[model samples]
Target: MTLQNQSGTSTIRPTIDTMDLEEIVELRTSHMVVGGAALARDANGRVVFVSGALPDELVMVRMVTAKKDFATAEVVSVTEPSASRVEPACEAWHRGCGGCDWQHIAPAAQVAMKTDMVREALSRTARVDQPVVVTGAAIAPWGYRTTVRLAVGDDGRVGFRSRRSHDVVALRACPVADERINGLLATVVAAGTDELSLRVGVAGAELIAWGAPGALVSGLADTVRIGATAVVHEDVAGHRFRVSATSFFQSSPEAAELLVAAVTRAAAGLDLGQCTVIDAYGGVGLFAATVARGAERVVLVEASASACADARHNLRGQRAEVMEMRLEAWTPIAADLVIADPARNGLDKSAAARLVQTGASRIVLVSCDAGSLARDTRLLREHGYAHRGTEVLDVFPNTSHVETVTRFDRFAPGDRANHPDHV
Candidate 1:
């Protein structure tokens, strides 16, 4: 079957009978695929990929491309909804801004799905049978995001890209944005001339608007500082943080507090008090200072020189040694605990292997991307570390991204004999 769009583009449509007969398979082992939602297999037994559908959803899909080994389809309908499915909160999500995913799933279900994805990635990719627990977010799902970037449309209106395409999607307001940002958006949109992009930051219900040329517009109260440390806010974890427009800090203060607490708790069981500790990818030293409270000596490894300078200011009085070097080049000293909160890429193979080689008694990995976490965890397990446990933190709500804290203990072949069921 074939369906044509208004633009005269043709798409192959899958038969309803075939969709109804296809077996249910889990996408990324998190989302279930059923009915027309599942891609049809050719006579050669190669599976196809379907979009805009969820698990248990009976969709009548239109195949857009069919290669020799695989195919791609677009969903037409869903006869049944997955138990986890829910109405998407953001109407602009389907337009493909690349900002949020999993908006159609319930918040609780999203967390659970992320937890399962982490566990499966560990077991299959890392070959560890470790148990995982999911945790709730620190703040409300909607209106919790404090920062957002929007592309300026050709029509002089700021908008976001469509869900899966570069085409701009017109948006009057963003639901996930804080009310303060929305208010600022109104003013910006009203006074717009031809700005290519707009970046807004919200702090405690006050909005600070920055134009494409990096000039402040309005809605800021005053610059808050702690001693020489100057930021939009002074208080973070009972200490002052020197934050700026470019400096990386967690947008949600509430969520940041919860995440910091979780990381602190995860490190409590490990004896970092007397041993040297390395906080790799330590941005602004938020976690470094928190973890340093317990560690006798802490070494923060960062690649960004500017962030390291900020770290120096943030950790002025704290007993921490800052090393401005990449994680790959920096030599690893044996430590009690190593906390790594890397970017979305997680840890490269070299860094992951190096951490294992350091022989750190315990490793706490904080990741925003589950797939990368799973891949790194598997790498660690292969290098003689036993997965202790994993906890999912819903840092970014109303979106598919999840923060996870995974603990690992260095293991020897005969060590498990003393402690059975360790893995």
Candidate 2:
């Protein structure tokens, strides 16, 4: 959601050699890779990942990073551009706002690229030969975001950070943000803080800042809530969810509804009414409060205390229990069903093994990263769980991110543990 595919470098910087950094190389990209970059090879047959370019396009690139295994480069110019290339719709993008990565690509092409990315990840990493399809959103791509975080500069100007740097790119408007959010840009007060958060909740527009509002914000102080608001309510699929400031929620209500329908569809035939559902890595009990509501009993495990509190409130009076703990650290209780939504790195070996230990026959997994999804799929397969199917949705349009909902069924023959006593 270009999420919000950002490239970060954790590796230590190597002492630069002037010759390599100064050399400009031209290469034709073969295809898009996992991290929203185009794959190509230089004259020396070295793998080169080119940013800001598309497949089958010849671009002149300059090396920005040099590693023994591979290198990353920035596009100096596109010698031959793909037909899918389009002028980015936002002035912020042209001003070097790193909010999106696929802004230069056509919308339809963006979906196609994300689909191919999922298929390739599964095939290369999970060893699955199944067809992958990603459904595009029905609503217009622009003005869908209900949440936006801005970085404040030394000059008190607020906007998004630049691409591949910590510098800020001041903005007057953001194209992808909801129209209401864009309206707050002029009135937003960035005083006394380096970061600001804006959101559209059921109560209305909210501006989250740590301290008291100054005269800069006094202009709209009566209109917008510009203080520490405990929880914001959002209506999704006929349900209102109490979301904390730090809770993980979908970018917009529409995206949340789309994801909810996808998860419910993936869990079909489970007859959740009579089953014990475990919402692993649950944040604010989104799945538990909605799709898993009718389950006989529900247990939600989360790492964030704030989310746990919100989950308890969101799932109040229901047969739901909120456990504040990390997924890998939680002790498993035998259940009939499970829903796991781990972070981008996916479940580590220990975490995946713990999930398998739950002995839940029906499991639904939500993944935001393709590589992690493929790896976790392989790990689950090794634990006697068969990959039933996967559904992907482009909830975040105009970005390189896609939400994947996958189902797994434990099919260990003659294994009593796979079927809990409740079943």
Candidate 3:
């Protein structure tokens, strides 16, 4: 049947009832998408997504699946290459190793693409036309990831999962992972477990073996344990954070500091000496601890017990208070500012409404997903908050994930004086 695409192009599409399911097609890639797929238009004007190909390149693709308007393919060969394309740093790049998708793209080009993606998301989704301010690319893109979880296959191969598949690709080392983490791969393989995690910091490396007996633990790192649980200490900005296997911590120490600095800059101009601040979804109190020096009273709201405990430990001598509850369950306290760094899902809808109810004059939202950031930005806009500005940080280099810090100011003036019920 003939169809018109979003780009105002007319073409023919084969029906599922009559189309040759095993047909191969040639695709000239146009651009990259989230999750590292190179998007191209097929002969019939239908979208085709293929991996291991760069934009402005001609690739022979083996169609794996076909849908009504689009198809998914795997690159069989690259007939042409882009100037920004480079040989993948990892030998496992084309082997379906899903760890680093943009490893084939130049580091500078990757950062530029991420910046454009964030800016486009804000412009198209959040209705913000302002140019996004992006931080410079990482000085050391390779060997910067402080933590990584390696999946173990049934055959005892330790590596990462395949892109959009359950298949595990074995690896000797990951270029994006820290050298210390790569150094423990041998120990992880010896643990004889289904999965394992390695975390490295100033204190040293810690290994967490999943579904393995505690007896498997040895001198792989300074601290090693089994049962998929253990806390690793990370020193950031003069503060120490005890991060567990499940707790969230920035993978790159340098980028984490940059994020904290962005948060601090966005939260400036408040009466920090006497004003109260809330760190919503404050995993391990990264923001709370960093901003606590200026905040007279800081309340950290986290749902993870382990993360809350870590926050409590991290903020022991500071003036911050830890609340071990979800943002939706925690009672709203009047404050001068609220800083939320939620997961990829962004803020809960109910809790976002409640955040508006808190009547904080300033709110800083730090997010990893641009789509969620845009969604939550619109939610706050509907509640009478003005989007001041945003700064994008290239924390996760060589990947589509982008981190953004957006500040919003409430339009309706609220009382800045201390309230008796305010924490």
lDDT string, candidate 3, 306-365, tens digits? 888888888888888999998888889898899999889898679898788888998999
Q: List candidate 3 stretches off by more than 4 Å.
A: 1-22, 130-139, 190-193, 204-229, 413-423
TM-score of 1: 0.78
Candidate number achieving the greatest lDDT relative to the actual structure: 2
- Superposed on all Cα atoms, the candidates' RMSDs to the truth, in angstroms, are 6.8, 7.3, 5.6
Identify the runs in model 2 with alpha carbons over 4 angstroms from their true place. 1-19, 131-139, 202-220, 413-423
Residue-wise C-alpha lDDT for candidate 1, range 249-272, written one tens digit per residue = 675666677778877777776666
Candidate 1 lDDT (Cα, 0 to 1): 0.63
lDDT of 2 by residue, 80-190 (tens): 899999989888888788988889998777767876778788878888656344554433578888778788777767789999788999876788888777777765656
TM-score of each prediction: 0.78, 0.87, 0.85
Cα miss at 55, model 1 (Å)?
2.6
Global lDDT scores for all candidate models: 0.63, 0.78, 0.75
lDDT of 3 at 422: 19
Arrange candidates by TM-score, descending: 2, 3, 1
Error of 3 at 161 (Å): 1.2
